[model samples]
Target: MNAVLRRHAGYYLPFLALAAVLAVFPLVASTNMVNIGVFALIYGIAAIGLSLLMGLAGQVSLGQAAFFAVGAYTHAILVTRYDVHGLVAAVTAVLAAMLVALLVGLPLLRLRGHFLALATLGLGIIVSVTVRELEYTGGTSGIFGIPKPEFGGRVYDSPREFFWLLVPFVVVGLLMARNLVGSRTGRALSAVNDSEVAAECLGVNTFLLRLKVFVLSAGYAGLAGVFYAYWLAVVSPEAAGFLLSVHFLLMVVLGGLGTVWGAITGAVVVEGLDEGMKALIPRIVPGATGEVQLIAFGVALVLVVILLPGGLAQLWEMAVSRLRRRGSAREPGELPTVAVREGPRDDVPGTGEVSLADLLAEADVPERGTVVLSVRGLTKRYGGVVAVDDVDLDVRAGEILALIGPNGAGKTTCFNMISGVLEPTAGTIEVLGSRVEGRAPHTVADLGATRTFQNLQVFGSSTVLGNVKVARHLRSRSGVVRGMLGLAAREEKEIERSAMASIAALGLAQDADRSVTDLPFGRQRQVEVARALALAPRLLLLDEPMAGLSGAERDELAELLRRARDAGVAVVLVEHDVDAVMALADRVAVLDDGRLIALGTPAEVRNDPAVVAAYLGTDDEADDIVRHAAQEVR
Candidate 1:
């Protein structure tokens, strides 16, 4: 109950306070103050869209004001020129904005960071200039005479009346933004922001994701513009000016980039400051309001950058964290804790003796077992560099094959080729005997080949369990549209259960609800592995799964891999840990400079002269000969 109260107070107190001010300000303040409040609400809405672009998808867009103006113009034209109903005009404006966003985003979202910002800044300038020059848009004088929206013989004519009208939309927009950031779309967007290359490797289409977010953000800006048009009963080129774009950018940077509620708070604070400055500067400084306010804005922005670079959300987080730390320090080790039970160890039934034949039979692939995958003459080249040179590999049902190599030996390149990431310069990849080469990465993943990266690629923003749940979506009956509509075929209960199970598989059950960032590095690696295993692929490709793990963790992973193999899943292992590889591999393949050097049983490979030279260097002949002679008879 206390935690609930704290959470509500942390998240909703500002909103509740704003609600009270909006409700009572009309009675206490002048009509002008009420107008200022309404304008703040509209700016808040635009800021949410800008926040989505800059914060979530990691795209820096300064053209939100352009999209904003386009929406206002759309609403103005539809209502005045086409005689469209006010509500219909609002909807049309949003759709039109999305269309413009799509056209702009398809090309502009292709650019990264500074380039994106420059492109968007150019777009905003274009929109501002176009609005000024186009006669249909009323030129520099701006469009006027837009009447208040009327519904069922009722019209909102006064500022006070429109405050009541706009408040609900402001609330709804906040909720919608919150819901979006918490959904799959939000997670994917955050992932893209953090690392586009990593997200692409995870089968996320970074291009389409950027475009989707671009359109969504523009749609929100459009809706806000429509509301602004109706509220003001006029439209102006200033609505899409470079200054307005800068203001939205300031809001995002000040409030917090990635959090929805932060965007809301940022919009209110920045716009409220603008209004306060407008009122105060004119009264105190008389004729210097314009220059004085610009100087003050610049100084305030500098202070914000210096003092709170991570933004207001980080400030709030820091404050709360400090309070929690103080409270926890008062009672050391009393916070909360969880215990994990290890799974039962494998043993011969009621026997003290364990036979090698039995162990080999249990670990071995059966005759006529499903051939889950086949790779034939797979070759990849980077210019004159042969990254993977005519490699042939197969993964049979229920077998674990380890790929061992020194650095730069093309193991990863082979994995990439098989996973459909790098299109092979030559060769065929087949899943279940069906040729599937040159397919997209997601298509290869959908066809039952899932992999984990050498370096951890866990979604740090999401909970540990949430990371795994996303992989479950690969097999989900629901499409993206269906999930957005809350009509996913699988029940929430089932997804939750599956997610928990996957989390448990890697002994991360205790950390399921914890943000992956908070976990130890080894555990984060486990989360990555669990996420890949959640796909339930017929063949799993683990790229250095034991990398950066402790002795205990390596043992746990080896046991987990053994259990997975026993359960009828084929695995391709790539690791530098020779001890673990020798213990776990049924067959080991060695590579040297993108060419296969040796393929044999662990005993044979351990003694192979070529393998020793590739690993220990050719100069260590005395040690190599002794080691080879010792292991040759094994």
Candidate 2:
């Protein structure tokens, strides 16, 4: 219990210090400075939400100000016109903003990059124009006479009082944001950001996850809006303008992209700069316009991007790392390179010095010969081009089936169709008896199928353990709310243990906490396999898993696959290494020009006259392909 408390204290001490500073600021600062602090805290809440959407989820939004205005105007209207309680009105306003985000996000989240940004910008414009023209919104003049929040017969009416009132909200918001970014949901969001297709194959519904983050972000903006309405006791159309939205984006960017503290730091910096300019500009230029402040902001943004692209948060991290390194003996960012102790040698030829019995022993082998994947007449076409012609395949438990062909033979297309990354032009795919041909990738994954990509899709920004943990998405049941509330701590620990087991099984335990991008290409491939194995899939698809590996690495991977087969995994490997495939596969299926030409035991397929003519083009090449297979089987 003490150890857990100490760990949590280390994690939260910075936030507690920040809250203390915020609480003490109003007591010492002048009224004008206190007012600026109030605005900063209010905008900090919205900026944190935007950070989660853009920084973590990699979804861009340019309509945060519209949501902010919705909250402010909704609260103002309810308080002034209907005489509603401030607390109830605040909740209602936040819900209204979330509803708007939900309606807008359903279709808009489908768009990517600048298209999504533009769509969100249009939404902002529509909201701004509607609020300006509507009578209930008080048109261009905006709503007035908003009531101040009262609690226990005490009213927060002054700038100092409001600043103090906002400190708790900002602190709670930061705590929740911190909790979320360290949870399973946050890891999945990072996975989606890194590779949406990879995340989907790991059983994450990318569209739904993006939509949920959007709605949550809008709720944050709305909460900020509620406070903004009460702070001024009036709401204006300008509050919902494009400029405010841009400022919110700027806050997150200037603070840091992926850190929760970046949001508050950015809000404070932007607000402070604006206030400083207002006071200093008049004295320097006598009649300087607001455009001068805009120019200053642009210059500052450019400088920050060029000098510190990761923003102020990056600078803080660097400083803290330096301090820790100075105090400790170890160098910063240095990871241990200790290898796992080798086990007893096995009977398998060319199995190398390292043994995998300890690694593979824990896998629960099902009844052998149980068919795990079935495909019949599967086809894929692009206009006049047929990528994959009618193909039939079945993979049973306890066997490794190699799908071999030349480049552009539609090997990957078959894998894509079977894994549900692409819809088949015709025919069916069943994994563990569930029809999955036209279903989404997540659905396929949920039915106990997982795959590794030809071009590596490991999450570059995450640690090896982190990458593997994302595969446990379907296995874990915690959602965004539970993650944010820190209710999934126990589940997260179990996930880490499972992920570590997979990493260890793949001989990557030493590098488990290292960022995957820092590893060699071969190691990264191992990471991908570790992630896939963590899913505990009944059927595993490997699109050239051995590509770019060394001879020794190839042997290691081959042995690993054999162990997986022994453990009742159904593996379909697509590869160009004929010797490795011939020696490793129980059966080989050959494809030529999108058509299956042969399927049989390695010897049977290699000696087939048609396969020899079509695949290798001659008997000499076919002989060369099977030289190793004959030696291994004998």
Candidate 3:
């Protein structure tokens, strides 16, 4: 319980600090300053949502102002025309915005990058134009006379009161955002941002997760809009204008991309700067207009992007990190080491090597040998060319099936099809009895199959432990609400423990806290393996897992795979290293020119004439290579 309290204190302490500061601001500031604070707080709310969408989820949106307008208009119409209670109307308005976001996101989120940005930009324009034309919205004038919110018959009318009212919402927003980005769901979001395909391969529903964040961010914008309407006692079409959406984006960018506090900081800086320029620019320039302020913003944005791409939050974090490092300076030439658990190992007699047979014999583990992955007549065609043709295979538990072929022989393509990264042009795939040929990767993963990529898909922005924890996403049951409420603490701790075990299994426990990008190429591959192992899948597909490894690293990885197989995991390894394939595989499936040429025990496949021909084209050199590899395996 003390551990849990300590964990939670780290999150809430900042909230209390923020709350205390907000509580004191109104007491000390003048009325104009208080009014500015209100605007900053409102924009801060919207910016927080934007930060989650773009900074964390790696999604871009230009339709946030549309949701903002939806909230303001909905609240204003509800209170003035329908005489709804202010608080109830506020809640309804936020829901309305979220509903609109759901509707828009269903179709719009399908597009990515600039396409999604432009689609949202168009949505903002459409909302702006629609509000101007709609009669109930009061045309271009927009709905007005929005009543102030009341609690127990006490109205919040003054800027000071409104500022105080807004503070709690900001605090709640920050707390929620902070909690979310630090939870399992947040790690999944970071995974999605880093690589959607990889995230899906780990059983993270990328599309659904993206949609949820979109809806949640829209809610934030809508709530801000509700406050905007009440505070101004008016709503206008301009409230949903494209410019306002740009401003929200700008605020998030300037403060920090992925940091929770960055959102609020950005809003305060941008809002404060805008007001300051409006008051100061004319006095300095004698005949300056709002256009000059726009120029100033443009210059500021360029400077921030060029010098501090991670934003002001990143700058502050760097400074703090540097200060801490200086305070705890290590002695020259001394290195930090973390204890790594290498797990139990068995060595083959006279070879000083860990062989598959040795591992199988040493462990008293039972072999289930149940077929976990069944692929029938799998084919992939690229317009006029067949990348993979009529491949049939089955991978059973407690076995390692190495899929090997020469370059362009469709080994990776076969893995892609089975893992659902690519839809088979023809044929069916069943993962643990579920038909999964054309399904999304996440669905296949959900059915107890997971895979690594030919190109490493480690989340470069995260630590090694963080990367592994993301693999445990499907194992946990936390959603945005639970995460935001800090109710997922126990589950998160369990996930970390599990992830750490996997890391330790791969001898990466020492590097658990290190950023994956800082590791060497070979170690990064181990990180990928550790992440895959963390999934605890029945079927594991590895595409070139030993590509960048040294001989020692390869041996360690082979041992790890043997251990996994001993524990009933069916691993399909696509690798070019013939020696590793011959030594480690229970069965070898050889592909040639998009066709499966041979499937049998590693020794059988290695000596097969078809396999030799496919690899070396019936040459004496090819025969020698195969013979030598076979001898090495023995």
Query: For each candidate, C-alpha RMSD in Å?
Result: 6.5, 5.2, 5.5
| Alpha-carbon runs more than 4 Å astray in model 2 | 324-367, 617-622
Output the worst ten-in-a-row residue range by lDDT, candidate 1.
351-360
User: TM-score, each model?
Assistant: 0.86, 0.93, 0.93
Which scores greater on TM-score, model 1 or model 3? Answer: 3
Q: Give the C-alpha lDDT of model 3.
A: 0.86
The lDDT, on a scale of 0 to 1, for candidate 1 is: 0.76
* lDDT, each prediction: 0.76, 0.87, 0.86
Question: Which lDDT tens digits does candidate 2 get at residues 72-132?
Answer: 9999999899998889999999999999999989999999999999999998999999999
Top of the candidates by lDDT: 2
| Model 1 lDDT tens row, 482-537 | 43444432343344555566677677877777888998888888888887776666
lDDT, candidate 3, 1-634, per-residue tens: 5765775588579889999999999999999999999999998999999999998778999989999999999999999998998878999999999999999999988898999999999999999999999998999777766777888767899989989989989998898888888877788999888888898999999888889999999999999999999889999999999989989998999898888799899999888888887888788888898999778767867887789988898899999999988987889998876545342222223323222243223223334777788889999999999999998898888999998888899988888888888999999998777899999999998877888889889998998989999988878899999988889866766677677777877778788878899999989999998888888788889999998899988999999899888778888999988778888999999888899999999778876887776774577876676777788678
C-alpha RMSD between model 1 and the true structure? 6.5
Show where candidate 1 strays beyond 4 Å: 1-21, 282-286, 326-368, 433-440, 477-493, 616-634
Task: Assess candidate 2 and give its TM-score to the true structure.
Answer: 0.93
